[model samples]
Target: MPTRTLAGRGRRFAAALLLLAALAVFAHPRIEAAGDALARIDKAALAKLTLDEVEGLRSVLELRASWLVAGPLATLERLARAGIPVEVIDRDPAARWFEVTIGPEPKGDSRRPPLADARGREVPQLAPVPLEQGVWITAAVDQAAGPSTMPGSRVIRVSAAGGPALAVAAQRVIQRVPAARAEVRDDPRIAALAAEVSPDRLRTSVEALQSFQTRDATTTGALSAANFLYDYFRGLGLATRYEDFTFPGTIDGVRVTGLPATNIVVTIPGSVSPDQVVVVGAHYDSFGREQTRVFAPGADDNGSGTAALMEIARLLARGPFDFSVRIVAFGAEEYGLHGSRAHATAARAAGERILAVLNLDMIGYTDRVPEDLDVVVDTASEWLGSRYIAVADKYAPLPIARRLDPLLRASDHAPFWDNGYHAMLGIEDAVLNNPYYHRATDRVETLNFDFAAGVVRATLAVAADLAQPSRAPAPPVGPSARTGFLRSLLSRVKLTELAWSPPSDRAAVGYHVYRSPTPHGTYQRVTGSPVTATSFTDRVTSAADQVAYYVVTAVDGAGRESNYSVEVDDGTIRR
Candidate 1:
């Protein structure tokens, strides 16, 4: 147990301020290391101190036997003077917290479900405890179908991929959040970057890893996989290293200790703020049936995602960004996310400023006609998911299913979320539509390259956007404007058609059209969003007499806008 003393008034005040700052920013509030022993200050001693001292002590000390007091610091100080003993209860050593995604209860099974995967295997759902919104700490067993002890009447302990499992207990569930639509827009630079993603390259990377057979953390193949990834990144001339760790857990029925694992880390230092990081990570290790670890070929399960990470690294390697980008190939993810947890914990301790983490788990193997993807995030990181969805729509254009549940802790992103960092999980299909989730037959051939490439492109676009694209697209040229009429179902609509030539810079993605009453007057943006094409159509009151001056500017992949093109008139009535 850790202990601290509240000796000096100034020291106590500083500690209180630190605690308040932690509470404001982070969900898991923690005080800085205090000392080796707890302060034994009695109620009478506290009564003699000032109001600031009393308030400081309240935050620094733990209450014993549960005493409740309402209102502000004044009330607390009064109560302390009235002889309330301020004692600290020893913290529980066995207490552990998990942040889990809640699905409906399992059907026919009398036992209430613990955290599980799509296949109903018991998986650890470890994350930081969300205190404001009460969560389940212990596994509920043998509970009936009335009401859940979890807050907001939300279901608990089911996988995000287990859609069928939720249907069984639909009657008992109070609420189900409907999947929201992804925002769509066009960016020529993003589209260009996305187009650069090679389906063949993705396949080659996946196949190379699949050839290793088994990448279990304890197996020799795991070391080979790590070396391969290290060499791959090193070949790119990026700063790369192997982050090593030791883990202890149960395999079969026997307890194992000090098993070694390796995480491959690659860093691309930013041109501007190098300390602020954008993380792209995926687990490289895999698992199979209990009997044999030698034949596990985890292609679709994680190979697709790992390949996506490599492809993104390749795209971003073209140039440096405003923020540092860190790519990690995590090991031992199947064995309770040991690699990610260790990394996230160390990052938090070191005060690494992480902008966002895009964690890919299984981003291939779709059976449907239109390829779809699932993005999972917690309450705090919903913006990160929204940005991912928006970028996917613009860059990849695919069906997306979004889940805002922190309880979905099956992947590497969970550890980042646990440490109070913004992270999201991008998966091919959360429902586990693939037949070979954890089987030995999981191979590269089973993965849909079309779907995998699109996912990779989307991930690349977003990662670049977060890292802040360093170069702005060159300004567009050859602007012209003309009036036209369109026959709609309701009536004839008059409009102005603005056209421009593409920029010389390959980074240019789209154009933003602006309008002005006079050539010398203020130009207002006419288009709501960036237009993908070089031409734009703006609806007008009348095509016959309406006159407008127009200008266009080029927008790049990072949403940076270049200088406006030379002004042009509507031609109906020249300025």
Candidate 2:
């Protein structure tokens, strides 16, 4: 009976051994397949692809097994590339699957994966699959990796429940990757070429050119076009200077000394090539009544151009450029380009290197002609001039017509061309349009502000495309202090009351009233000086005299003048 029991025990032992052998064989292939799949992964490719692609790849990897190890490495790598520093946790085979945590990697930390729960206890929850039946046993990884480990990593663990998904996520993260940096040359020649093509710089040059204007000759119109340019350029922080040229040939044989024809010039020093100059200019004078009385508010005639120049200067002031830009506001243009002639002549005599000349004249008016006005490119300087027209057409809101007119001799550019410089004139088709030309009605209200703004914008664009200099052009000069104050005060101060009033009981001065037909026109002295009287009985005029304007200036005993009272005008008087 003892022998029989022994035999049975042996049989049972052999059977158990055989079963264990078969299980080992079945499990080996699965382990190998999983290992091979993980090994074959191209980590670099994983890093280059977007997150969506990586997720899809993870799905494909997961199909081969029930559980996989993954971590937050993929996200860490992306963040690192974007200038964040990070560290990845290591893995341990003893803990069924690899483990990983993401955060700032500190020095002296073990590169191997952790294998315990959050409280430094061994996480035996990780499930191990049997080689034969694909059955998994659960086990937990230790969570005492460090305080630096991210909270998201812990959340992922809770969601994964320490299963294949967690392993897959950890594996996905383990494959940390980086993006490839693009290679580019930083050669000085290339930088120079780039500087040459910079549109902002060129625009600055154009703006600087716009900063010269003609000065008013009298106190009545306290500011001249030239003064406007000065203020504009100075406001832009440009180093501006002037050249006064005398046009002494007398008007009507009267010796007119210092018939001031001046050119306002501004220079922007270059960073690399300061010797080469990009030139731009416009005339600042306007034609109207004599240069003595009455204000010739030449706001649109060339003020538009001058103002545009000033704006350019302001734009170009903040630049790091490679070439010099020169702006000139030529005076005596209305008197026939005398100032420009002097400037161009001097430049030629000095053998100055002038690349291009952009002349802006009458750029404010946009009344007649096709709504699509042609931007005339002088046939002589078509190479650069055509580019301006083309750029304007390509970028400008308005259609720029490219015309090669034979009559481009309207402004300062003519003198530059006569001096053999490359020059182009920017003008409206003034020959056909300009109803207010040299007329008393040429006020600011008569001009199109929108059209003026467009021209300024277009001119700025063209200038930007050409000079390729750095910095914004300056603003055009404004009216003088006295003029500005007077104008501002006059504009706001309406004539509230104009009834003639008698002086009070105390002895008072006599009142001499003057009158003019227009705001800025001829004024005639009234016939009588009324004494301390409120009402003036005009004994000289009949009731038939229509349209009377009156202003009262008080004259004291010593022939001193008081402030002129408010002006009053009555409609045409009917007898």
Candidate 3:
């Protein structure tokens, strides 16, 4: 590494240390060899490139700290040892990027992003949290101050909790700094359960999710995705429901309001301690930068997460747990985590005993270049985060990199943490922010399904250990299961009156009515919402003569749905 500054000018260094675009796609021996050779570039290698070539390197490298580095992972250790001071400033895990300030700032075009959000509001570089004294997360820095070329302009203060490397890194780049490290081990009981995870199912689920045009919070796609998950869980005999909330008003701390968002919720009740619960959540929403109506194919942003969640649901549904496991396909997470905030707030208000939440955000991306898993943990959920890491050690092949991002509140997991629940996120390498993220290019083809499966297996390990699932009967007991239908015709319209005895169970809160032309499979809800009373009037106008079969299921306070009552019909239709 050369240490020199040209007269009246900062050194113009080329950033192509290693890992260029073509090399980034494959993890081959040739690429590895090139990276090794490039890592130790001396005066001899540096002289071969002309100044013009040095300037052209910007296409492949980025100005990070004082060094023009290929990737943070490839350069962080070298920079640290070279005695080059590095200060990480602003970082967006969703965007999979970070901004840093290094002393002896290099001269090129300073990559100071115009700091403003969608509404033209200045994005804060730092803000004080009401938590502990001297703690601050990145908030909007003063816009008037503009850009400064000073050595420490990018440095800001931050305090975080997690592994030692993370703690140290947090302090090293803070516009100001705080404390550090952690380790985890395996639980074999969980590994045996994780072994049953089917990678084929995981890929199939992702493919199904990507088939939708767009799952934006404001679009009908959101509802459609939710309904699909609802039916899937319902078929598995698990308690299922749709948790709905409007956006803007739904998400906390966000000023925006009145967008539609719904979370598909499914629960596998604990056999013994049914009240104790564990949550495995994933956001199903996708964004395309003002292209909600068009194709925003969110295959990786969250289609991967949503798909992985389904695989977990399918696996866990086969067994009953000691602690109830609720798998939620959260909507509007792309819209500032509105769906989750709504659910968590309600869960907290109702005094639900949520033991832990494992959120899988973007687990389907791997440059295939760097196979790493970034388990993001905050100060609040360090223990839960460590447990997940230990589980990954036992069942997953992806290398783990624990990052302490106390201020990184970018996913569904954050809302659970706010509601005083232990939550952690499982994601692809945070450093390798997928190139196709948030774009129309983020399709299934861009995802590494094999890598995603490993992440799911790791998550399944965590869920199995925490929930400790067993088995349940085909249909739950203690609910009154009787129903009848009466038909009447007026004008050209046919009306069917439906009635059912209330479930004898003390916990019964409401009943859900389902109707379908066939005996099984696709069923539609006749009632707009859950009916509190046992009787209801049904209206239908159809000239076609065909029989419609109906069934009713009772729901309890904990969202448990009883077995369906006997089917009722509007007298067999005569053709």
Report the lDDT tens digits of candidate 2 across residue range 60-167: 112111222233334333433443222111222333332222221112224435555445656433322221121111222332122223232211111222122221
**What's the residue-level lDDT of 130 in candidate 3?**
13
lDDT of 3 by residue, 317-357 (tens): 87655568889988888756778888988997788878789
lDDT of 1 by residue, 282-385 (tens): 99988887433678889987888888888988878875565689999999887778899889878977888787899998988988867778898764466577
RMSD of 2: 36.0
Q: Model-by-model lDDT, in order?
A: 0.63, 0.44, 0.57
Give the runs in model 1 whose Cα sits over 4 Å from its true position: 1-136, 139-188, 290-292, 472-575
Top-scoring candidate (TM-score): 1
Model 2 lDDT-worst window of ten:
475-484
Better of 1 and 2 by lDDT: 1
Q: Find the candidate with the highest lDDT and give its number.
A: 1
The alpha-carbon lDDT assigned to residue 217 of candidate 3 equals: 71
What's the TM for model 2?
0.42
Judge candidate 2 against the unseen true structure and give its global Cα lDDT, from 0 to 1: 0.44
* Prediction RMSDs, each to the true structure: 18.6, 36.0, 25.0
Q: After superposition, how far is residue 118 of candidate 2 from its true place, in Å?
A: 99
